[model samples]
Target: MGRLSGKVAVVTGASSGMGSEIVKLYAKEGASVVAVARRQNRLEELAASLADAEGKVEIFPGDISDKAVNEAMIDFAVEQFGKFDILVNNAGIMDDMAGVDAFSDEKLLKVFSVNVYGPFYATRKAVNTFKEQGNPGAIIHIASEGAYKTCAGAVYCASKAAVVALSRNTAYMYMHDGIRSNCIIAGGFKTEISTSMGMPNMEAYGKLKAVLGTAPEPGEPTEIAKACLFLASDDSAYVNGAELAVDGGWCAS
Candidate 1:
């Protein structure tokens, strides 16, 4: 049951969805967790809920796109739990449905900053933290099927594709240092990002859901959390630079 015993993990986008679920599961499996998100109250709630679990949970509120914040997160984890062992780069946002003709520089930059740059910043700091301790660590990045297919807006798809590349590069760069990196290519799920982007009503959300040809039932966040656990734990010690598709077979189509 102690899959991550004696581990310390930093999870971004922990306010809700897969990030939140990962925090809970990690703590349950015996890893101290630092949950980072913009919503302080939500993070607090998560920490409180994890009280009495096998491992501790701490809340760190910040925007992940900021390099300083990512650095601070690593520092805090080291300060609070000694040395960091895992990082789950799960924070992401959906872009407005716009093709190339309708895309704006602002939109493109914002998505790339969060989905691409944010992970880069976090991975760098996490690797540095691991290096400082001379211990091997694991990095789990939550990418999406949009990375390979045009399920979402052009900008969103491009950003995810970049994330896949980033994860692979991180794995290769740190292979000699015992730092492993992997990407989870998630399929359509009932995430806040998927359900609330320009879909004014349920009907509109449903229409877009149908058009995307996603599975009839969206994947639950817990499903993704399980995959994160594998990557975070020693179970995947040899699995690096791997892209595991956790979609509901959406990528198959």
Candidate 2:
């Protein structure tokens, strides 16, 4: 039951959905966790709810898109615990389903900032923290099916593609140091990520809905969390640079 005993984890986007589930499971499996998110109250509630877990849950409230915040979170974890062993870059925002012709400069910037830049900043900090500790660590980037298909808007798709590339490159770069990085090619799920898409482009949404209509039923948050646990634990010691599709066969179509 102690899958992650003695490890310390930092999970971004811990306020809800898969992020919340990941925190819960990691704590129960005996890993100290620092939950990072913009909502202070939500993070507090989340940490309190897991008070009886085998491991400890703490909050690091801030917008992960900020570079300094990213670095600070890992540092906070190390200060609170002895060292950091895992990083889950799960916090992300969705983009309005806008095609190339209708791309909004503001939307492009916002989506890239949160979805792409947030993970990049967090990864850099976590890698450094692991190196300082002289321990092998795991990095799991929550990518999307948008990386390979048109489920989301062009910008969102491009950002996810970049994330997959980041995971692969990071895995290759640190293979000699035993730092593993992997990407979760997520599929349709009943999550709050859509709330970020303020006023989606109608034409683009229509096309996306058509493609998604053929996909399998949406998955639950715990499903993705289980995959995260596998990657974070030593169960996947040999699994690196993989684009693990957790989309329930939606990507096969």
> Against the hidden true structure, what lDDT does model 1 obtain?
0.87
- Tens digits of per-residue lDDT, candidate 1, 1-253, equal 4899899999999999999999999999999999999999999999999898999999999998898998999899999999899999999988776766667687788888888889999988888888989999999999988788766777888989999999999999999999999999998776677532553234333445655764546889999999999999888999999999998777677
TM-score for predicted model 1 compared with the true structure: 0.93
Per-prediction backbone clash count: 0, 0
- Those runs of model 1 whose alpha carbons end farther than 4 Å from true positions after fitting are 195-211, 214-216
The best candidate in terms of TM-score: 2
Give the TM-score of each candidate.
0.93, 0.98
Q: How do the residues 1-253 of candidate 2 rate in per-residue lDDT, one tens digit apiece?
A: 5899999999999999999999999999999999999999989999999999999998999998899999999999999997999999999988888999898999999989988898999899888878888899999999999998998899999999999999999999999988999989999888888898999899989988888787898999899899999999999999999999998898778
Per-candidate Cα lDDT values, in order, are 0.87, 0.92
In angstroms, how far off is 194's CA in candidate 2?
A: 1.2
Highest-scoring model, lDDT: 2
Residue 25, candidate 1: C-alpha displacement in angstroms: 0.3
